[model samples]
Target: MGIVVVEICDSNFLLSLNIEEIIESKYPEVAVLFNDCLGFCGLCRLKPYAMVNGKRIHGKTPEECLEKIKEAIEAELAFYA
Candidate 1:
């Protein structure tokens, strides 16, 4: 099993997702970390932005963002396997 970490910064929308809850529900092994600022203001301005394994996703809804993150995590796990 691999560890998944979600870092949320200044983005209010991202914070609203309650990422910890979602990750724990779906990916138990995955760990989510909420930070103050990822320093990606340009992307944050787009709203509902997140970084999935270091890749930036901009202007996403909570559901959409979670889906993308899950997909990325699955892909990472597959690579390890």
Candidate 2:
């Protein structure tokens, strides 16, 4: 499969949940990047969200968002497979 870029804002709540470790451990092919600012305005401050292969994925809670991110990653990888 090809590389799946998962971009998350540094201030996102997902970081508090060790999202980087969780994603890397679960999907070694996924490159999770934490940037100082994703340029999404104030979205990061209100909810859990990330960019999966350039597609925005978000949820009301961190756990929910993480699940969505995984789904998006799988979908993106499927395109290569």
RMSD of 1: 2.3
- The TM-score values for the models, in the order shown, are 0.76, 0.94
lDDT of 1 by residue, 1-81 (tens): 326566666654766767778776877766676667888765665667666667666555767776777787788667766
Best by lDDT: 2
Writing each residue's lDDT as its tens digit, candidate 2 over 1-81 gives 339999999889888688988998988899888899999999999999999988999999999999999999989889888
- Worst 10-residue lDDT window, candidate 2: 1-10
Residue 16 in candidate 1, Cα distance off native in Å: 2.2
Model 2: which residue pairs collide? Answer: none
Largest TM-score belongs to which candidate? Answer: 2
Candidate 2 residue-wise lDDT at 10: 87
